[model samples]
Target: MSGLQPLGSVDICLVTMPFVDLCRPSIALGLLKSALKSSPYRVSVSYGNLLFAEKVGVERYGLQKFGRQTRLAGDWVFAQAAFPEHVTDTSDFAQQIAQDIRRLAGLDRDPETLNRLAELVLDLRDQATAFVDEMVESVLAQTPRIVACTSVFQQHTASLALLRKLKERDPELITIIGGANCTGVMGVANIESFPWIDVIFSGEADDQFAPLIDHLMRSGLAGLDAACLEGVITKTSAIQLRDVSGKDLPCAFVSDLVTSPQPDYEDYFTTLRQVSYRDQIVPGIPLESSRGCWWGHKCGCTFCGLNGHNMRYRAKRADQVLNEIRSLRQTYGIERIEFVDNILDMGFFDDLLPRLANEPRKFNIFFETKANLTRTQVGRLKAAGVGWIQPGIEALHDQMLKLMNKGTTNAINLQLLKYACEFGLRVIWHVLYRLPGEEDAWHGESAKLVPLLHHLMPPTNFVPVTVQRFSAYHDDPEKYGLKLQVAPGYLDIYPLDVERIGQLAYFFDSNLDYPSAHDRHDGFLALNKAIRDWKRAFANEDAPPILGMRDEGESIFILDTRACATERRFRLEGIQADVLRCCDPALRSERLAPVLAEHHGRRYTESAIAQAVEALRERRLLVEVSGKLLQLAVPGEIPDLPARSTFPGGIDAPPNLAALIGASAKTAVAA
Candidate 1:
């Protein structure tokens, strides 16, 4: 093993931020690993993203509300799609199903629903744990002492728990915690709460970690307290009291997790984890180009963790980034490369892509960015073979966008979106609903959003967000005037304390006021109630009829009866309405018939028509494939729309302009 081969002993293990799958361990532990070289202590590094079931509940419940329809629909599609021979040969599908139940700890899922989703995630977690454990043990055999766990996502909670289990098996091991979440809340100690975590470094752990490890190796735990631990919070303190230094840590540290030979992938294995191929997967090398946000500093949105607000950008040399890319492709059969940066800078991308474009081996690439990238940037990226970019466009309202400080206006956002679409680049957008805004405001914003959906449609992507912790209003409720208290539920991860930095600490027991001018809690509350009611009504067997119109053929499938009812309520007078999903198209007859007859001329009761449609579905007259948006095999024909031509740069010609009216045409006509 390398531990015995004299690279330096592993005295400390460090995890990176967002311990989620994309965590670039190479960046977090890379520098410290290098500094320790030639030292007597051997270094073994492992990264972790912890798993707390309760936190999962909070997150999942919110997700369920936001994406319940789509995700459920996706799962059904995945289940119906036959498993490939490789997947089926690897494991027993039945056994995998059983394991999913045990792993989910009773997460909400119906008996017939695709339980494979749970199984897949559990399999990945197991593979990740086993792989990390083996690597640690290999180093530990040579007398490695410390183990560090870093996380990018909430999953780090689970990784931390696994490390604790590993610690029990080897009491001599010391566990360290550091990452984004750790950086935010590390000044406080809850040693009793998490007995496994020792020496939690709150902020950037690079410079401080090596020195701390050196002291530990020399003195064997002596002078640990007096060490220069900036965000270090020991068991002795309840709050994350900032150090006297008063300076925030650096954005990201350099690490071997990058340069070091990719973990021996011969041992690399992943079991049915939710591994998404969203990005171009380069086999060996991935890049983390920047640290913190350039924008998130001031625009602390209510439900954000300051992702875009805490801006710290340090672009690596373009040549160096390209060199790493070249080495990975040459050394290993890796063609896909993922940019793990928070947001790939446009400048960096422009420099990197043009060089790689003419290379012998075309490298597929992926990155995330905020909304409103320019048309030129999109065109350049597409030419460069960049597959996609994920951006958070959380809400559509100016007020909501302002609250989130998304840094771009809707007009700009829409323009950038159109460019991305024009360039045929896939863009994934993050969306949120039912936040702290007026009911009418939400509906108005949604109205604006629905039209834009046609402009920014997805196969492309959409991720919905509900409120979460340490975001603007939640972090400092007093300033934001948010006063709704979080009820003590299974979903609560952190106590509502004003001083805390991590978890749900800033909740109100009673409704609180925002700046007196914008206090619309009453309206927000009413809107929230309606949303909840709508959700419940959809789930209920006994509910009223619904009528909806979906664009039959334009690469789109929409389910919205809510919009029509909301429109009628606001635009017309004396109309009370309840809209619900109907298995029977006949149900559309009662309410829809009169409305359609009155509006479009001709129709019967909604329920009567809906029942006939449902019967057709049963008889195969209207076939509904689970994953598909359209009901298959229904007899129908719609005339093709006229083809539109794009002028040089996707600009539309003026409607009144004659086709013959051109520069050459004018000369010919004059002659």
Candidate 2:
């Protein structure tokens, strides 16, 4: 390795393409650099997304649009579906685009307005192309021999366009591509379509990069073979692919996170300083503590299509993880670390949580874990500085959970919400429907439970299941009872044959086993409306703790803070009050009379106690389970969170109190 020649300047320039949040560095590019450290070739990384800053800085596009949530902005850099070339003098294109965007964002728009989106797109294309040219020229000025681009999600179209223009600027400039778009079938599809791209590399390029870099450095542009390296795809002809990406080889995940050098984030920082809106540059250092999902290997959630094909979970030792965290924190001056793991290994509770809690400087971290987490585990995670968690609570109905093969009961999902809320850990999750066996009754049952748990985070979005590649549904569509078609967005983005689009697409529109399930008369429509309102209501922080039981001497008072339900606080006394007191430590309703008679010197008939508890159940104040009765109220002061939604800052700024109290407080209070 030492025999390799020392070269000046960057011989290989890795470009990270766009559409991801600017707030986090690319873990793929970071890992690629770490894996390639053994190679003697001097490679420097570049953030091509920063080049879009040129368009953003010139006031071509408003900063408001780049706020991530904004529907549309002043300038458009990323090219979506093809604009009509025939309508050169079209005046309707810009107007149509504006109107469509306004309608989509729920802004006021007249349906009669004529559309001119095609014309506006031409102007946008010109601006975006100019921006790409300027940046490519600057990179070429460095006389780099090769430029490798990483494309994922929305980055694909933009990367393809840039590489085309870069090659047009100097056709001699070698172009290599990788990332999510370059894995599996999508990689070969892209390589065949885009002539400017010289090669495509699969997800794990550890065994692939060194030889390619050496070949480029030693041989220059001449005599370079298409099949020189593993995981490399090159042109065999005008439209054919010469792929040497040996699918059987070990991937990047096989490299230990514990042993791999901390991802070199210097390129990201350097790019950040050059961008115009440094204010928007809140970068979280990406740390891969593990890869794959332990649960997926057992019975993967069918709706999830994460971690690609690598579903076998592997994790670093606790000490190795801690040392990596310390090294990353010391090197990058940032405490926020986002784990790129598919699922937090169950072992983290044993191996990692205790050690992290003992550290002098606790990290503000985020992880995706199983929704069936215990209250004790949630508490331990918070103590270990896990500020946010995405527990997989897609639905809160036992039947739906079973249909999705989630392995956890709806009761368990609801328990997680209560526990996460009590522990002050921010829970972020979505509720998805449209499973093969899901019924309208299930959603209604979930909506009914929302009121009883207003203290916990509500579902962020209620969407139907999307068919994505590599999911259980995709692996065997008929088994899941679905017939899939390509999404319409891809028609505009790629404009290829429907069969080709279906093969290349990551997302698809699907036909269900029960098409009548989506009928207008279906009960899920009401559930959707209810969940939307619930999501809105839960975003408010100053709302009084809905499920907290307040003790007042002989009487037990409960505040009904459910915004959607028309109910007020409840008061119970005598035997009825004693019935709830037994539930404080949670005793069976059948045993309530004995506990009351033994401890409080109050005796009541079992028949009288049943009637009193039944009355409480009618009011939705008590949760009855089997013979046991658990209090609806979670005992504790509501813990704080970096609350979700449009209001974005940490801990100090919560959603407004007026918003939380909603429109029916005094009315419900009077009831």
Top lDDT model: 2
TM-score of 2: 0.80
lDDT of 2 by residue, 70-141 (tens): 122221234431122222322343454545444443443443222222223345555565656665765675
lDDT of candidates 1 onward, in order = 0.42, 0.65
Give each model a TM-score: 0.55, 0.80
Highest TM-score against the true fold, candidate: 2
Q: After superposition, how far is residue 282 of candidate 2 from its true place, in Å?
A: 2.3
* Candidate 1: tens digits of C-alpha lDDT, residues 1-671: 12122224545544432223322224455545655664666664442221111112112211112113212211111221111111222233323433433333334344322333333333433344343445445435545577776544343434444456557668767766666545443324234346666666665554566666777677745566666455555554433344422124222333322332222221111210222321311223454555455555444345665442244555566677777777656655555566766666667656877887767767666677777676577667766766566666665445656656677655455445545645655555654544454344554444433421332323222222333444555556666455645432211222224333223122223252332456554533443444444334433434321322232332222222332232211110111111112211222223544554565454545565566555534322232221111221101221111122211111111211122113224544576
